[model samples]
Structure formats: structure tokens, C-alpha cells
Target chain A: MKKLVQDDIRTGVFICDCGSNIAGYLEMKELVEFAKTLPNVVFVQENLYTCSEGGINEIKLAIPRENLNRVVVASCTPRTHEPLFMSACEEGGLNPYLFEMANIRDQCSWVHMREREAGTQRAKVQIAMAVAKAAKLRELNRIQLSLSHRALVIGGGVAGMSAALALANMGYEVDLVEKRDRLGGILNELNMILPSNEPPDKLVNNLAARLHDNPKVTIHTGAVVTKTEGYVGNYVATIRQNENENKIKCGAVIVAIGAQPLKPEGLYNYDGKKVITHIELESKLKQGDVQAKNISIIQCVGSRSKERTYCSRICCMTAVKNAILFKEASPDTKITIFYRDMQMYGVENEQLFRKSKRLGVRYVTYDPDRPPRFDGESVSVHHLRMGRDIIVPTDLLVLSTPLVAQDDASEISTMLKVPINENGFFLEGHVKLKPLDFATDGVYLCGNARFPSTIREAISQGLGVASRAAGVLSKEALFTSGIVADINPETCCGCLGCVAVCPYGAINFIENRGICQVNKVLCKGCGGCAATCPSGSARLDGFSNQQIYAQIEQAMAV
Target chain B: MSDSQFEPKIVGFLCNWCAYAGADLAGVSRLQYPPNMRTIRTLCSATVGPHQILKAFQKGADGVFVGG
Candidate 1:
């Protein structure tokens, strides 16, 4: 890309109506007249929909005709439409980085629909700010990175296995590492899988067999990933086995280290023998050693409290499943479940809940303030419906505890350079849109590591995670944004504040030169280091300090 | 200027990922608010330096909001 001097800065402003989305609320003619008055704004045009084909062509044609050095589109948010305008500018012989955008529809028109005058004034100010920033906009080039074709699957759980299988089937080499001697993860201890009613080992064995037979997959048991370095396309990880450390390079990583159920040690006087968790009952039931004639189950044992606030989504269904199973095995066993609220979500779980009631399983809603009390033989609880204290004969007390994040979740999050929520679960990029991906490009997560998920959801997430990783692995080369930060070597004082505050580890201190430098490939353009640099040396290329100040000055002037 | 005649000027620096997306969502949902704030979309909240904020104030901005 060719660079242009400040004297050649000719900015063209395109105001968009968005097909009555913006025109219905704001005065378009006034905004256009206002945009024309801005400094260096040589051309101004109004579009019905700047993202439409005809609108884009007008931009392309106007660029060469008007000799535009910078293009500013005052339209809907740049989040969705910026790329279209930028590409149009590129086709018109202008660099894409020279394009700037102002959000008139989203920020002004839609927000102040009733206030026409005020909204138009706001749009004018936004256009002026964008034009001011455009005057200082510089062309930036994208950096292409080499990609590794292999993938790494951490934690050989159901999700991990599914991800590995999917990736291997895609003709990519996959390395699956499991910390335990076996590959099933939480599936090994589970008695019967839901929805299918098959034994847990059956699914585990089937996946393991498929993974083992595939030539692209290499399974490592009793192995853990101790270190992972690099970004999306190229990652190097060290797997630590008993005494040996083996290093493997892969393009993407899938985290499926499933969570563990809380033991409820002190709560409900849990002894693991008489007062045991629901998971403990699964083992006893599997062994055919559940000898109790009467069983009373307690829900929300160690969750939904001041400490652990989130309601573990799957625990209620687990309680219902166990209740139904126990009732079917021994019809005479008096089983009562005391819960604050039955969170049986979806059609299957609701059907299971109704079936449990049909099988003579009793459900009593107990207040958390006044919980059920056990005196070694019978359980006493205040029934909300009856408005009286009731006693139920109980020999085996089963506590259904929520599944918490894995013990080493924080360690893995740090090693991956990803973030974790306060509950220690790995946080995804966006809660709704990008559920299976981390903020970092290459790393993805699924199963209980993200949240307490059912076995079916975990498998689906595993497959979904593989697809997300493949989105990167399938690409021959990856291009990073040109908006990365750069430090002036002359002005750097080696304060290391930028280094200390960088979340992505993109900046490195040069000990020999006593300065800090930015690795452009690793930079995500968050600009944390640029703001923290006291000497004003570190400046993000696109969002320079001068550009932002110019914008503020323009905004205040209006 | 009279108290009622003087309209306060506010500049907001909205981060691209969160607050800016949220503002866009508000627009998509047609959630109305007073047109009292002028926004600048930034890559991150940290990109808004103290110098830029003081400059906004020095240029006669009544208030500044940095949202991530």
C-alpha cells in the first residue's frame, strides 16, 4: 500500500438513510449539509442503504471521480457494515485502512426517534468527528501468518473425544491428552447415560475405539498439557507424562476438562456413607448395594448460595433421574425429594420429572432459610404447601450438589492466556454468539469447563468446538488487523508498565536496548499498552492519540 | 447563557467489543434515550488516554463517559 501525505488528505462523507431506519427519525438533508461543512470533506452523498449494491457502487465510483483519499460513511454501526465500505474503497484504488465510519442509525436515529432536531444535531456531530479522524487516518497493512495443520485436544472427556474424532476425520492430525489413566473423564464413574439409558462406559468405549483406530489421532493417557505458547494458527504445547515431557505443535486447542461435583462435606452432615452425594449413590446403585428402605434426597446442597450464586443447571434433572431409577428398582422404598425449586428445563427433563411423580416419588418444596433437619433417623422439614412441619422416615440421605469448575481450571486458563469467570469456569468470547470460543483466536472450550453441561450438551459442544477450530485450521494463512500498536524506540523509557498490563503478552522488553517492543502478530489491538505507556511512545496505528484528540475537539466544537 | 438555554456537551468513548456492541443492540431494539452524548468508538476502553479525556474537558465538554 502506498502512503499519502497530509496535504493530499481528501475525505468524502457518505450519509446513509438505511431504508427508513435512519431517515424515518432524522433529517437527512440537514446531516448532509452539516457533513459538507466539516474540514477536508471534499465530497458528500446520501445513500438509502450504504450496504446495498447500488450504494456501494456509488462509493466506488465517487472515490476515483472525486479523488477521495479518505472515505467516511455515516451509517449503521461499523461493526457490521465497515468491512463493506472498506472493501468498496479498496476497489476504488484507496487503501481500506483510510476508510472511517460513524454510526448514525444505531447511535443517533434509533436512540432518539422522537427528538428529530437533537438526533440530527448528534448525527452532524458524529459525522464531523469521523471526518476529523479521517483527516489523520493512515494506511495500514495486514500481516499474514503461517498456519499449522495439526490440532490439540486437552482432557479426554466425552467432549474432548468428540472434538478429537471430528478433527481427525477432517484429515488433520490430532493429539488427545488425558490426565487420568483412562479416557472417559467423568463418564467412567457415571452409571447410566440419560436419553439413551445405555451404560456410561459404552459411549466412552465406542469413542475411544474410534479415536484409537483413526490414523490421524494419537491418544496419551496419564498426560497433562503443562505449557502452551503461541496464538491461533501456530501453537506449541508441552505434554507432561509420568517422567517425560513431549512437545507438540498444533493450530488449535480444545479444552474439555469437565468439572467435578461438590462433595458437600459439612452441609447436611454428609458422611459419604449414609449421607452421601447423588454421584456416590450412582456407584452404590451400580454395585446393587443400595439397601435402604427409605431414601430422602436434598437438592441445592452446596450451590445457589451467597458463596456459589449460580444455579447449576443440570443437578435437578440428575436428582429426578436418580429418584425415578431408585423407585423402579424398589417400589416399596419411600423416597422424598426436598428442593427449593425444581429446575427441570426442556421437554425431555420435564417429561422425566412428570414420570418421576407418576412413579410415586414425592417432591416437597423447602425454604432455604429453614432447611430440612436430620436427627440420624428421620428428616424434618417445613412444607410450604401444607404450611406445617412434616417428618419423613429416611435411612439413606442423598444430597444433590452442583458441579463446580475443575481444580486446575485457573492454571489452564493462565497457560492458555485466556480468561476465567469468578467461579473458575473458562469464559467464552460472547455468552450468546460465540459460546464455544475463547477471546483468543485459536483456543476453544466446551463441556463442564465452560459450565455444568449434560452429557448430550457436552458431546454437541465437543463437535461444535471442533468445527470452530477447523474454521481457523482450514485457512491456509491468517491475516491480523492493521490496527496493532507500535512503540517509538527513541521515546521508550523501559518503565515496563505496558508489559505488566498486557493481557495477550504481545509486548516484550528488550533488555539489551532497555526498551519494550510489540510483537505485531500477537497484538489484538486492545491498546492497553499504548494507554499505559507514560512516555507516549506506544501508539495504536489506526487509533492514534492525535486522531482521538482531533475527534474530541471536533465533537466539542459542534 | 441561561441555565435552560445551556445544553451540556458529553463525550463518550465506547469500547468496540462490549459497550459499543451494547449501544448498537439498544439501537437495534429501538430503545430510546436522550441525544445528550456524542460517542467515539475505540478498540478498547484502555485506548482512551487521560490526555484525550482532559482535552475533551479543556474543549468545554460538560462530561465524559468511558464504557467498555
Candidate 2:
């Protein structure tokens, strides 16, 4: 490859008409003429749509024809079209990073439709700025790191087991670590699995047996991940089981540490024997030990309050399922469920709720402000529909408490360099687009660890998380963006300003050298550290100070 | 500059994620605004330092807007 210096810099500017979206409002002819006057701009052209094939081909043809070292596309937002033009530059044998964009359509022409003269003037300045920046743009290379094909899954619950099974089936080795002595997680404590109507242990047993039989999966029960280091495509974690600590190297990690149901000890007069929780009720139902004829279940005991405001998504379904089961076993048992609102979401839960209602299970709505009174013997509640307080004599009081985050959630989040929401649930990369992924790559979240999901959603998410992990595990190598932060060692300042501001924890202070160095793989190119560096040691590769200043200098010339 | 006669030369520093996308949406929706401000897209709003804003002012910019 031939190297070009500053004097040899040739920038070609391609202004897009965007099917009259830009040209109809702005004066394109004048804009092209103005772009030619900008420094280092050797070629200028205007197209009907620069993003189209013909326009892209024109750009491709101009690079060698004009000996262009840098290319600037004054068209749509760079957010959408930067990659297209950059790839065009690459195909033309020019470095892709030596490309700049001016969003004339979105920010210029479309926003100033009526101001033809002013918009045209703004387009010239925008083109000039992009040309100015393009001259200073340098060729950057992406850093490639090797990958480990194996995977490590934390937690041995239904979600974790499902993820392990899926990954193993995909032909990748898996190491499943569970803190408890056995598998099954909360499934072991539950009485029956809904929809299937089989005992929870049966499903747990089937999953556990399948996992045990799988040749690719290695289950480590009575274990805890003591330390986790490294980033995506390569992770080294230490798992301690009893007296032994084993180091496992893997590409991706899946967090399936399912949540625990709140005990609601002091609240609702919960005393274990008479006033019990849904989990306790599951055990009683499993043992077929229902001695009471009149049973009352209260929903939202410890959740959806001032202390904990989030509505536990699955508690209402659990209450309805257990109610239906109890009514089926003993038809004469009069059961009334007092709820703030029956959150019977989804088809299965809604159908089960209706079935419980048909089975002579009474429902009552209660306000959070006025909670039901639970004296030693009976329960009293204010009915929202009846316009008065209704006293229902109860024997067994089942409080439906929310599932809280695991106690080690924060510890694991810190260790894995992942984040959790305010409610202690693992935060995903995106709520809609990347639901199972964490912002930190190579780490995934599913089951109750993310939020209170149903067994079905948990299983689906477990499989979904496996596919997401496969996206990384299947890759030969991972590439880090060229637009990462870099600190100049020559301008050494030991101040931890960049370290404090970097959200990704990419910058680390070298204790001996008295300088902060950026771990390129961990940097997301936010440029926070570059701006925060007081001594001007830190700079983001693509958006350097020199390039920004050139753009700023050109913007003022208009 | 007199208020009636003045045309403000503004420089905008828009973050790539939210504010820049919002400006694009405005254009996609065809919502018209004055074309006085020139934009410079940054990876984050933090990427735009005080020096850049002050430099814009020194170069005769009447206003500087930093939108994240």
C-alpha cells in the first residue's frame, strides 16, 4: 500500500440530491462549486442519490480518477449511510476510516425546507466542514482478537440448563456452574409446573438427566465463580467448588441466576405455619396436606409499594395457578384471592385465571393504601366493587410476594463488568432490539435474573440467550472498532481523570509508568475520556482534536 | 448586534445516539427550523469540550448548542 502525506491529501466530495429531498430545497449547483474551494478538495460531484448503486459507482470511479485519499459524502445522516460510503471507499482501495459525512438531507435541506437561500448557504458550510475534517482524517486499522469456542454458564436453574443444552447441541463445549449442591433452582421448591400440570421435580429431573447425559456439557454443582476477567471472545473465570478452584476459559458467559421470592416475614402477619407464602403453599399442595376449607390468598404483599415500586410480573399468574389447583383437588374448599389487580397476562395465564373463576374461586380487588387486615384468626378486606368492607374467615393465608434479585447479583455484575437496573435485575443491551444481551459483549442475561419471567418465557429466553452466545462463539475472531481512545505516553499525567470518566472501564492507570492506557477492546468510543483529560493526553482516534478543530474553523468561515 | 438586524451564527454539537437521530427524524418528518446553526456530530455530548464552544464564539458564532 502506498502512503500519502498531508500535502498529497486529495478529498472527493459527493453531494447527494436524495431524489430532490436535498436538491429541491438547497441550491446543489452552488454547493458543489463551494466544495471545490475548500482546502484539499480536489474533486466535487452531485448525484441524484449518493446512497444508490449508480451514485456509489460514481464515487468508486472518482477515487482512482481523482487520486482521492479521503472521501466526503454530503447526503443523509452518517448514522445510516456512513457505512455504505465507507465500504465504497474500501472497495476503491482507499482506507475506509478516511471518510467523513455531511448530513444535508436530514439536518440541512429537510429541516430548512422553506428557507431556500439560507438552506443552500447552510449546505455549503456543512460541505466545507466535512471537507475540512476529511483532510485531517487518518487511516485507522481494526484490532482483531482470537476467540475461545467454549462457553461458561453461571447458575444451574431451568434457564441455565436450557441454555447449556442448546449450546451443547450446537457443538460447543459448555461448563455449567451452580452455587447450590443440586440443580433445578427454584423448580425444586415448586409443587407443580403449570400448563403441563406435572410436578416441578419431573421437569427438573428430565432437564437434569438430559444435561448429565450430554457429552459436551460439564456440570459443576456446589460451585461459585470467584473471579471473572477479560472481555468478549475470551474470558478467564475462576470457579470455586468446596476446597478446589478451577479456572475455566470460555468465549461467552450466560447469567441465569434466577431470583428468589420475597419472604414477606413481618408483613401480612407471615408466621410460617398459618400465614405462609406461595412457595410454602407449593410444598403443602405437593404433600396434599390442605386441612383448611376456607383459604384466602393476598397478592402483592412486598412489591409495588413505596419501597419496591416494580410490579412482579409473574406473581399474579402463580396465585391464579395455585388457586386453580387447590379448587380442583378440593371442590368444596372456598378460596378467595384479594388482589390489587389480577395481572393474568398471556393466553395460558388468562385461561387459567378464567378456569379458577369457573371452579368457584372468588376474586376481590383491594386498594394498596387500605391493605387487608389479618388478625390472628380471620382476614378483613375493603372491597372496591361492593362499596363496603367484606370479612372473609380464612384458615390458610397465602401471601403472593414478588421475586427479588439474587443476593449475589451485584457481586456478579461487578465481576462480569455488567450492569443491573435499579430493581437489581440485570440490564440488557437494549430493551427491545437486544433483549438477551448485556451492553458488555460476550455476557448474556435470561430468566428471573433479567426480570420476573414465566417458565415459558424463561425457557425461550434461555434458548434465545444461547443463540446470542453462539453469535460470538461461532465467530473466528472479534474485531474492535478503530475509533477507540488512545492516551499519549509522552504527555504523561498520572491523574486518574480519564479512568474516573470512562464508563466502559477501558482506561487503566499503569502504576509504575504514571499514565493511563486504554484497553482498546473494552472501549466503546464514547470519547468521554478524551474530553475529560485535563492534560490533553487522551484522544479518540476518529474524532481527534485536530479534525474537530478543522471542522470548527471551516464552520465559522460561512 | 441589534436584535432586529441580527442573524445568529450558531454551532451545534449533537451526540450521535439521541440528539442527532432526533434531528434526522425532524427532517424525515419535514419539520422546518431555521438554518442558522451548523452541526458537528460527536460520539457523545462529552466529546464536545469547552474549547470547541469557545472557539466557535471566537470565530464569530453568536450561540453554541450542545445536545446529547
**What does candidate 2's lDDT look like per residue over A136-195, in tens digits?**
888898999998999999999999999999999999999999999999999989998788
Instruction: Give all candidates' CA lDDT scores.
Output: 0.91, 0.90
RMSD (CA, angstroms), candidate 1: 3.8
For model 2, the stretches where C-alpha displacement exceeds 4 angstroms are A1-7, A19-24, A53-57, A486-518, A526-539, B17-33, B44-54, B63-68
Query: Which tens-of-lDDT digit does each residue in A86-121 have in candidate 1?
Result: 899999999999999999998889999999999999
Q: What are the candidates' individual DockQ scores? A: 0.79, 0.77
Native A-B interface contacts kept, per candidate: 0.87, 0.80
Evaluate model 1: give its lDDT.
0.91
Q: State which docking tier applies to candidate 2.
A: medium
